[model samples]
Target: MTRYWVRAFLSGLALSAATAMLTVTASADKLFGAMEKAYVTNPTLNAARAGQRATDELVPQALSGWRPTISVFGEVSRTRSSKEGVPIITPDGPDVDSVAINNATSGNVSIQLSQPLFRGFGTVNQTKSAEARVDAGKQNLLATEQQVLFDVVQAYMDVYAGRQYVVLRRQDVSALEAQVKAARDRFAVGEITRTDVAQAQARLAESQSFLVNAQTDLARAVASYVQMVGQEPGKLSYPKVVSIPNSLKMALDVAGEINPQLLAQAFVEVARNSDISVAFSNLLPSADLVASAAGSDPDFAQSKDRSSAVQVGAQLTIPLYEAGAVYSQVRQAKQLASQSRIQVIEVARAVRQAVASSWNAYVGLAQIIKNTRTQVSAAQLALNGVQQEYQAGTRTTLDVLDAQRDLVQAQVLQVTAERNRVVSGYQLLAAIGHLTAVEVGLKVPIYDPDANYKRVRNKWIGTDVKTVE
Candidate 1:
């Protein structure tokens, strides 16, 4: 009867092991889909989009300099006067009959238009500067997106690693429980002392505590995922492990030169250069067509008399000196451009270092996992041999317990190494700047890069407001 029950128990354990080996889908939502929803629905990313749009408005504002400006203006005035009727009398006699008269006067109103003819190419340079800024803002938006994608990848990795820890700890707890039961059985049969059972019980309790800690880690990982991805992970799962890229060769080739953040910083230099052009143009003469028209008499005191005429002429302005303000600005912009170039170099060096280290770490951890798996298998074999010896009265219960502990420790290490391998793969991908919504296979809607620019540029301008190159 005991043999029959033992066979049934062993069969049940085998089925459980088989179930664990299969892909468990605790989450109903696909990984990429959840990430997509997070990308489009995240408030933080939306705010970034808003900032980009705000930056795009500068293009039209600068372009306005090349277009005509019109305005309608008016003003009113009242005056008080004193008069005497006896014009032929002496000044003292006329003062005896003086009287005060109050008169109210009014205003004039007309539309005024002034159009730019030439600005020493200042306006052109300004338009180019705005264009560069728009490019920078667009790239900044991309950087924000890259950061969000990195957060998602990190959250996914955390959950995956945490789940592995939980599963391995549970296995350890189960093995220790079995050992304790075996020790108790041996004690009752006079094959071992009470001390053996006590030791087994103590180890089992420690393993159970470790399981609780694993649960805590799982909870924290879930919270971080929710914070980053903007929703509670109901069907959270990491079905596919992130794989390392071909090798460090591909990574080193692309790390700093192509990383999104670094690429954006490079464009910043272009923007600063554009600013220098704008500043240089400020030192030159500017000319515009100044015109005015109105229906009015020369004397406002005239009654019901209105005359209208138009005048047009060029208004020129030349900058003589400004306490070295313009030169100072040019110097500042040039220095900043130089600083940006240096930053690109610095970032490139940093990324190169990270790529080398992360790649090696990833490959190293992968090898560690393979070796640790072998260790686990060997420890299991040793534990089995010791168990057989205990049954044959050639091994103490203490010896069997130590072998079981070794096996559990080896299994834990193997699980950890596997988790680390996947996490390191994520870190390496992020370091390369290829981690984005589209790159990660998220099905999210892409925010258009030129959306705001097009919206502002495609608007009303005067008939002659062609792009005067």
Candidate 2:
């Protein structure tokens, strides 16, 4: 009998090891690989890049003011005329019963070129404004990249924690099932009362319900993971904690320098200031160099009645008055500039706030993780002790059930705390502007937002647009 029992124990142990191996194989996906995939495939990040490319066109549009415009025009026409006169006695021979008709066809073509000499410095100011806006757009793109990556991190962690919770709940359900059976066996042997058996059965039902809820939550988390990463989640490995500044003040200082949102707002303020100059420029004089060449035939009946000419001159226009429209535009621009300045301040404050909050949360989660780990260990010990005491008749079935429940809760708390710690660490990195793909060393090509700008900014003629791969 002893040899038979030993063989059975070894067989069960081998089966458990095989199951663990299978679980490990199924979850071999690593966090960084998932992030790299999302960085390449996320729609939100790609859309932001497209939007930035569109913004780059503004530079060339503004530069057009400094270039000459050429145009050609042509015209063709036919003319017919008839005259009738009363009969006259002498004079010319044809005057006796004079009637005359004439027909003529003529064509002409002309070309003109105009180059802006000066536009009250509007071109310069507008170009400056457009360039600033493009810079701001690049920063916005960076912010979008960070946001998408952070979202991926968040979803990955959620699914990771959700999977753990489901496993714990399943284990809890299995433990209670065994406890319920043992309780029934004891009651049948008159070693325990019906009440104890009922309590054990009730706990088992509750654990089963918890297991179902945990499973549902895991499904939702997987759906979210798919949405963020643009694919189904594999078994996710735990993400490594990202580095952050050592002190809150240091974090704030770092954020002030590199935070994408804050820098974008600052660029907006610069653009707004340039806009004020552009609007004020409208009230100043503008000059253009205009040149044209033309040829015309006045009448087909007289082939010699042709003329050609070339003209060159400078044209100047001073805005004396525009019914107060230009003045109102100038005022509007000034107000907008003022608003942008305030927005910069607002964004700076918000960035600092985010940095502080993320730092605090990260620190707090670390403590929670430590405490929950301790609680899990203690609860496990207490459950083992209660189970042994119940077998010895020194503890009740209720005690054992309560101890089991405590252990499960502590284990769940530990998972949650650890998950939150990872997430908060990422959040802190994002707040300090360090959560970008390149900063994280993702093994993918870094997207240079300026590449599109450089390609399009100086292009004088092209209907074709180059898209980034």
Candidate 3:
């Protein structure tokens, strides 16, 4: 009967294991699916894209310098004299005490257009500077996307790792409960002391406590996953490690070429160089073609006495001096350009260091994962031997318990190493500037910054209206 019962117990355990594996397989959600959702729905990423669109307007604002500015004016006024009536001269004669000349109502309408002929090449450089800034904004948007995606990857790993920990903890609790029951049965049958049963009970209690702590950690991980990916985590599919750069040197090279932050700073340096050109241009002369037409009525209610005039001329402005502010600005711009150049170098070095560190971490985690898996396997074998020895009365119950504890620890370490491996790969990808939706091959619409820029850059009308949302 005992042999049959033992066979039934082993069969039940095997069935439970099979069921758990099937459940995990059936309920799995791919990591890329979560990443795609985050890329599309993360508010931070969307806001960064919107901010880049806003920065796109700078190009059009600078382009406005090449376009003519038109303005219209109309005014009505009552003119009155406080002094006594004085003599006023008409076209034909002079009149004394002329109240008509002292008081009158007048109105005028005028339209003027001014086109910038030249601004010492300042307009050209300003537009170029704006273009550089727009490029920088694009890089910044890319950096934000990388950052959000990295966060999503981290959260996903956290939830998965936490779930694994919970599973191990539950296994520990179940194993200890069985041990406690076995110890109790042995003591009642005069096979073991009450002290053995007490030890088993103590271990079971500790395992239960650990299980509760693991549950708490899993809850926190779920919350973080929801916050990052915009939804609750389901059963996670097997993690996929991203392909890495061939070598550390290649990784550093890639980062220098495409790391979004470094690229953004590079564009910033370019814009600052253009700024210096704009500042120097301020010292040179500017020319504008100005034209105006006006109509005036002396008395709207009286005679048809109206006059019209038209004027067209070119105006040149020479900046002789302005309290040394222009020269000061030029000097400041040069200093700023120098600073930006220094920052570019600094950022490059920083990128290299980040890539190196991330590469080392990824390599270390890979090794740790391999070692931890081996450790789990060895520990499981040892625990099985210890259990067999305890059944044969050749090993103490405490020895079996210690072996079980070691196995649990090894399993936890294996899970943690696996989590770290995936997360480190993501870190490496981000350090090399490939952690973007497009780079990751996510099936989502890419936001184009130039679309809004093109929509508003050549917009000549609606000066007071906004054309892009």
User: Which numbered prediction scores highest in lDDT against the true structure?
Assistant: 2
Compared with the true structure, what per-residue lDDT tens digits does model 3 show for residues 1-469?
Answer: 9999999987975675556445544467788988998988888888887788779889888988899999999999987765546677988788776655357798999999999999989989999999999999999999999999999888898888888899999999999999999999999999999999999999999999999999998888877767667666777976778899889989998898899999999999999999998998989999999999999998776667989999999999999988899899999999999999999999888888889988999999888989998999999999999999999999988998999999999999999888888888888999899998888899988777677778877776665533333
Regions more than 4 Å wrong, model 2: 1-27, 79-103, 189-194, 299-302
Candidates in descending lDDT order:
2, 3, 1
Q: What is the C-alpha lDDT of each candidate?
A: 0.76, 0.89, 0.88
TM-score of 1: 0.78
- lDDT tens per residue, model 2, 1-469: 9999999987975675556445555656777877898888888888888889899999999999999999999999998887778554565454646766778899898999999999999999999999999999988988998888888888899999999999999999999999999999999999999999999999999999999999998888877776677566777788777777889999999899999999999999999999999999989999999999999997867879899999999999988898999899999999999999999999999998889898999999988988999999999999999989998999999999999999999999999998888888988888889989988889988888888889988889988986756
TM-score (all chains, Cα) for each model = 0.78, 0.87, 0.84
Itemize residue pairs with steric clashes in candidate 1: 27-235
The runs of at least 3 residues in candidate 1 whose Cα sits more than 4 Å from the true structure, single-residue gaps closed, are 1-28, 77-105, 177-202, 234-238, 241-245, 295-302, 305-309, 390-401, 458-469
Residue 176, candidate 1: C-alpha displacement in angstroms: 3.5
Off by over 4 Å in 3: 1-27, 78-104, 183-202, 463-469
RMSD of candidates 1 onward, in order = 11.9, 10.9, 11.4
Clash totals in order: 1, 0, 0
Tens digit of lDDT per residue, candidate 1, span 138-247? 76787788677667766766777777778888988887888888888878898788998998899889889989998998889877776676555555555566665687
